[model samples]
Target: MENRQTEQAYSLYKPLLFSLAYRMLGSVMDAEDVVQEAFFTLYKSGSDHIHNMKAYMCKIVTNRCLELLRSTSKQREVYVGTWLPEPLVTTASDETDPMQSYLQKESVTTAYLLLLQQLSYVERAVFLLREAMQYDYDEIADIVGKSSANCRQIFHRAKRSLSVKGVSDTSDRSDLEKATNLVEQFMHALTTGDAARLMKFLSIDAVLLADGGGKVKALTQPLHGHLSISESISSVLKKWPGSFTCRIAMVNGLPGIVVYKDTIMWSVFSFMIRDGRITNLYFVVNPDKLTHVQ
Candidate 1:
């Protein structure tokens, strides 16, 4: 009966647990593992020495996840060119509030998360918990193991630093629209073999990252320079052999282009547009990751 009850409790908290983990780690696989590990710890404890199972479990999960993030920062720094957060599919239920959900559904898209990587892990934690999850300072302090006063300070610092790093980028819908419009023109150039025009739409130091997971042939290294990116885009278009379908879709909460072949989803591409041109490109061609999504 005790074991059965534990399983029931875990089931009830699974969604919340997953959300907490995802917001912390930014990777689905890691989030799933953290939740499993948290539940394992919870089950082994046998519900003893706990006042609130929900909050206690959440604290455990977030701390474990924070530790993991702290350890992984070094690995991420040395990671392959133009690292991006793992792409996730956000559903209607993922929102914290119906109204906030409606507003943020168009705000927190995949492109937004990619930009978020520019933040330190602690800032990301504080911002996501306080802003996204609506956790109070006291609750956030519990999760982060800091004093409530310190938690507020941390969040304040995060906001100030993030402002310099483009936290306002998400709120600026006009900028996103203008940038995405340029991406559409860039894609259209691919089909029309307008190399010069395509080059015009890219920054001189533009970077292209393709997350093919080694399943398909992709640039083993990031493509750099406006000329190089233009050549690559042109070459791929020349080889594509047909009129491909492209649609503007929500990538996380940011505007992104969804690519398809026939009725099947082929790739999800998001652009990093700045200064009236695309400065970077992220192509998530990882078939396994897209399995549950598409």
Candidate 2:
């Protein structure tokens, strides 16, 4: 292939490749890894012939992410407790539009990504590529190495398998503003160590996931409901005897908070707000993932 043709192909397929990789890996860092590795393997490799360049490249990316995921499972298994996916971004508006986020909003909502968590890695890849990117069944089949009929069947199963908790539809400004405000209130409660204020913002069955990644001492199990989560947070703050500052920041394209020390990185929290209450909190204090803070 001529240099121009190869470059053009790269540009044309970049979005599609990122979408596939992101869906498969659920981490932008991992997605970029898969994409770059695929580019080198298929494009720079002199001996290999890439026929149907788009399909061929996507297959490489999907397979690479799957292999990485397979290898990473042992780490998750040995993890201190309930493992959650890393929150890659703070907001969609930083890179794309925020209005139709979960459309591209998997990064924003823990609920949406949690749905992917339920999928077997293959089913996750197929559903995300097809549902979000509009990849044809034939194309997905080519990438996954199955008949188109099988691809369709698998994707259908993936959809049926998803138990869409905390899922929301096309929310209007008033709705989004309401949720954003609730998050702000919750943050204020935490920052001030006000248990009474924080309790007002959480529902009875709300859950919190803290990902300190064994680097920092954090709750190993999902913190349940308003009382347990609130008392835990308030007690920690009271014991620490210092203010952990948080700023209104973009996380995965919705309202997010990046808690910090004196110019040092701390935890980041993303909200899952619904029915005027916080449904879930994804607290990411993992220093490895926090390096993405900009």
Clashes (backbone N, CA, C under 3 Å), per candidate, total: 6, 11
Model 1, 155-188: lDDT tens digits are: 8887766534533344466775676577678767
Alpha-carbon lDDT, every model: 0.70, 0.74
Error of 1 at 182 (Å): 3.5
The estimated TM-scores of all candidates read 0.65, 0.86
Question: Model 2: what TM-score?
Answer: 0.86
Estimate, for each residue in 1-294, the C-alpha lDDT of model 2 and write its tens digit: 555665666667766776567656667688777887876765566424656777777778888888999999888778775555556554545445332333343333556776788899889878876887678998998877888999999999999999864487314667767777877887888788888888899888989988877888888889988998888888887875565877776565456688876558777888777778877888887777777675
Count: clashes, candidate 1: 6
Q: Candidate 1 versus the native: TM-score?
A: 0.65
